[model samples]
Target: MNLTTKILLPLIWLLCAIPAGLVQAQQAGQTKDNPSYAALADLLENEQSREKLINELRTMADETATQAETVAEEASAASSSSRELAQTTRAIAEGIGEQFTALAEVVNGLVDGQVASDEQFSLAGLMEATLNLSLVIVATLLVFMLMRRLIGPLLYARLDNWALHGAGNTPVIRRVICVALAAAVDVVIVGLAYVGGNLVATFLVGESGEQTTQASLFLNAFMVIELLKAGLRMLFSRRYDGLRLLPINASEAAYWNRHMALLIGLLGYGVMVAEPLISIHISAALSQGINTLLMLAAFMYAAIIILKNRRRLAGIIRTKAEQSPMATSKISLHLLARTWHVLALGYFAVVLVLVLLSPANALPFVLFATLKTLGIIVVGLLLSTLLGQTIGRRIQLSPELRRKMPLLEARLNSYVPNALRFLRFLVLAAVILLSFNAWHVLDLATWYASEAGGVLMGRIIAVAIVLAVAAAIWVTCASLIEHKLNPETGTGIPSARTQTLLSLFRSALAVLLVTMTVMIALAELGINIGPLIAGAGVLGLAIGFGAQKLVQDVITGIFIQIENAMNTGDVVTLGGITGTAEKLSIRSVGIRDLNGTYHIIPFSSVDTVSNYMRDFAYHVGEYRVSYRENIDDAIAHLQNAFEELAADEAQKPYVLEALEVAGVVALADSSVNIRVRIKTVPGMQWAVGRAYNRLVKMHFEQAGIEIPYPQSTVHFEGSRQGVAPALKLEQAGERYSG
Candidate 1:
């Protein structure tokens, strides 16, 4: 009904009927009542017993071989006499019948044995299935190989030539060719593996020529291994070529070295995967060990080259820094040290990973361990490179520092960057290891060693040592900041007291963080941490009560910080103490008084705050003029002067707007007073008022307006002496002079 059945029907019938017709042609007596033949016939008793019949017929072939051998021997003895030969033939017939009966018994035992065995997966069934599958696969591959070897090549040849003609640079064509070649290789290699596996399955259980089966299995395995080797070599070769095309020459060289190392590593992996399967064929442990060592040596040599290169760069950078010391950062040396440490760690990681993933080999393991250690040392140099570059990008030195250390510029610019990159690599390594653990491919306990019981106590000690070193560093940094901010009691370093407090605060915080981190890390390592947690809690509570003022200061400081009421250089009056603000820190506020004395006030004491620099200010004063001067005239003069000053080039920049006088503000005893008010720049009110006063003075003098002063006239009549005149005048207008 289907195309496959339609096509296969005729071929099947022809092959089957040919064998049937031959069997039919045999005479009835000649067909023999042999038990072996009867057993074979019984196997085909039902349509479902086709496989059983085929297996039985194949078994009968063995009996036929034995019978033929006996008949040949008897005929040889009777070759000289026909009667003797005929008698021998009859004897052979009786012998053949007996042999056939024995074979039938054997066949029945085999069938019974198969049935008696656990039937989860039958060797007989597997053999039959494998043989059938192999036939189909082989036929399909035959057609595929023909197409690949013939039509595929032909098409490529035409297309490649066409590509060349169309484009001078035929990179596309080259890529296509490369891809095609790779694909062809993959097809052939994988196809062979499939075929080899199938054939081996058939030979193990199928009823066939034992010698032929063994031979086929051997050839199939050998071919598969050869194909795998060829495929690996092809892949490595292409990768090597591709590595040469990178933009950076150094990077390319490094890549090539690393690439070769990886290839060698892959070779080691192959040997490991293949050795168990092929151990029966090749049992030479010494030879296998040698090959594994050789592969490891290749990678070790590559790592050495990369490490050596990194070290050389680091040394060059250091030399450059020394030559131009002014060019490096203030923290250049510190960063360099960190870089070295990280690099060494990374190098060790690479070596360790490679060795762990590789198969165990005696000489190779020793050599790889040595290389790993050496590589780790070199890793520090690599780390320094990135660190140098990163420092260069972030903190640019003052011009003076640059001039002081000229060679340091290049070192900072180059090595720092490499060190930063190395740090990133280390972080990535940790992440990758964690990811492997998550994936169940790696065990975290095994990785840290401290997680395992008993023997891991040494690791715990080492971790403690590391934590101690970290705490020391933290404390040292705190001490430095303290010394910078606050000097000794007798010392006259301004803000020394503040600096000392800040340093103490920082040191305390650092200690707390370090201690907590150590506790957490220990817990992760599965340490018993109950006492540590209790101690920390008690210590925290004790410190909390003792540093209540400090805590309050910090809290109040935080409010100030959040509100942004004042910054580094604002003038503020707080707690009735006014001064120009110098610095606003988390724990305290620094201010310089008007007398130039510095005050470090804790934020807790700063409940009331007055900020002077907000919005605007005012300049108010009273101006006087003569009573003889008209109010309108004085006002007109003041307005003119105010307008002129506002328009002046020197005053214009500071003046936000021109002044407008509010006239006739008050009437005094000596003069009609007028208040003139004007809006001005926020902080420029003083300057504006000053400039206006000067202008108004000059203009009022020109306008002849007299500024009135309190005066009185006294008169004495010369008659009757001064006494009589004083009395008479006092009684009259009360005009007197003294």
Candidate 2:
């Protein structure tokens, strides 16, 4: 163990350990032998394997370096994206901070008057502007007050009379028109006031024709606010009750009008006058701040109004709804009663947010949106009302027309009521959606101006045209069928068979038209009808398999109809039930018997149909007479009875042929049966038979022809005791009448 030997041994150990550790750490990949690492020391013993191991090491090292580079590149890219996102966020935050700082700075400038007024204005510019605006307002008010005092009473009286005389579908409608006219009058007053104010601003205030900013602001505010006040008068109309539009009474209307006008005026004046005046002299920030405070105040006021009147107004509306004649109006009134406050609050809240977000143009936008919403609602209501008036609640055909076409009005009514409701619903939804668009809650305006909107509108129009055509075709076909069935149209009364076939045809035509219209409408709406049609066909096949009895009924009925076995209004015997066929359908027959019992018999249940009224019918009479009577005389009397029946106005038309007598039909135990037959029109045989029998009874009585009835003949030899028998006849269960 020399020093040189120890140093060499330690250095060799270190070299061997370093290589093993390097291979294990660097090579994580596995091999076919389940080994991921192989030290150079282990491979050095095999000279041929050494080269392969070296190659494998070189390959693993290269792969490791490539993977690390890829991971580094990915991490670097991720870092770069994150950094960019952070920078963008920081920039947005900084921009917001700068905007806020600017707002604060501009707002602060007012405290020390640091903001520069225009060269045309001075240090006291805001005060002078306020004074000029106040004078113009006073002048406008003076003009309005003078004119109102002169004609207000007379105008109200005339308007009230006109409103009372106005014709409309509903009282609310007529009064609404009157109120609108009244509002127009108020607008005219405002127009006069605006003109006066304009003159004062131009001449008295020495402003040019263009008018200074403050003068213009004041003049515009006066006109807008006064016009709003006038419109409120329509709803209120405390003095002229006939001009009131709302359902509320005069007191409530006045109270609401006063409060709402105050709030509206405050908000309007603040936004139109104060803000603009401040912006002209102080700063835009101060103007915005004032507007924010004004809006908040108005909101608080509106909240108070809602809290005070929510329940009371709801009760009033509930009463009105109960009193309403129209079901739809009642439902709408009830809904509005419940949601009115929520809707009003939402409107104000939206406007507030908008004004705060963009103080420059938001106020004007909100104002215009309010006007647009009102106009849209008014127009929609008018259109729906006009439509309702045109269609009415039910189809009412003239008596003559109804007689000529019994089912035409019924068929029209079947579609009309539902279509009317659907149309009204569509109108209401459009109005609401348009209102939302006006409020900027939706982008309908933008969409309506786009290419897709044009295409959708075109498709909708095409669908409407298709539906219209379908409706016209259905009406024409139905009318023709109805006319054919009618006896009053100069055309002769149709046969029972023809009537039934035509009725069934009309129904089938209606079904086909409806189906085609629906498919075409769905296609126009961009729905694929192919799958729907296939599904329907499959469903029909399945139904046919599952409902064999129903199929049998339909098939049997169709064959029976084709053969003209029976028809509506025919006297027929079906399934042992003798009745008149009141209604005939594809799969069933509705029969009403003499006892007023109605039977609905499926065609499958009817194996036989014995139509008594097919063509001509026979009234066969078998009259029994005593053996002693002459058969020729009895037969002659029967012929006389038929002759009398033929002479009757009611029965004459029923007799088709003279009587055919068959004398001595049979010799009964006590009487002779003489049979006679007479032919009459189909369906009138029963009446003719009844009349003939009555005549025969009368004729037999006059001719002394003994009509022998069942009786027991008593003789004196009866008692069996060789005593005379006495018989007394008495009636049981009989009540004598005077």
Best by TM-score: 2
For each candidate in the order shown, give its overall lDDT on alpha carbons: 0.55, 0.80
Among residues 3 or more apart in sequence or in different chains, the pairs in candidate 2 whose N, CA or C atoms overlap within 3 Å are none
Error of 2 at 545 (Å): 4.9
Instruction: Report RMSD (Å) for each prediction in the order shown.
Output: 32.7, 10.0
Those runs of model 1 whose alpha carbons end farther than 4 Å from true positions after fitting are: 1-570, 575-579, 592-598, 624-632, 648-676, 704-738
Candidate 1 lDDT trough over 10 residues, lowest sum: 239-248
| TM-score for each of the candidates | 0.32, 0.73
lDDT at 459 for candidate 1?
60
Per-residue C-alpha lDDT of model 2 across residues 64-108, encoded as one tens digit per residue: 999999999999998998898787667645644555676677656
Clashes of each: 43, 0
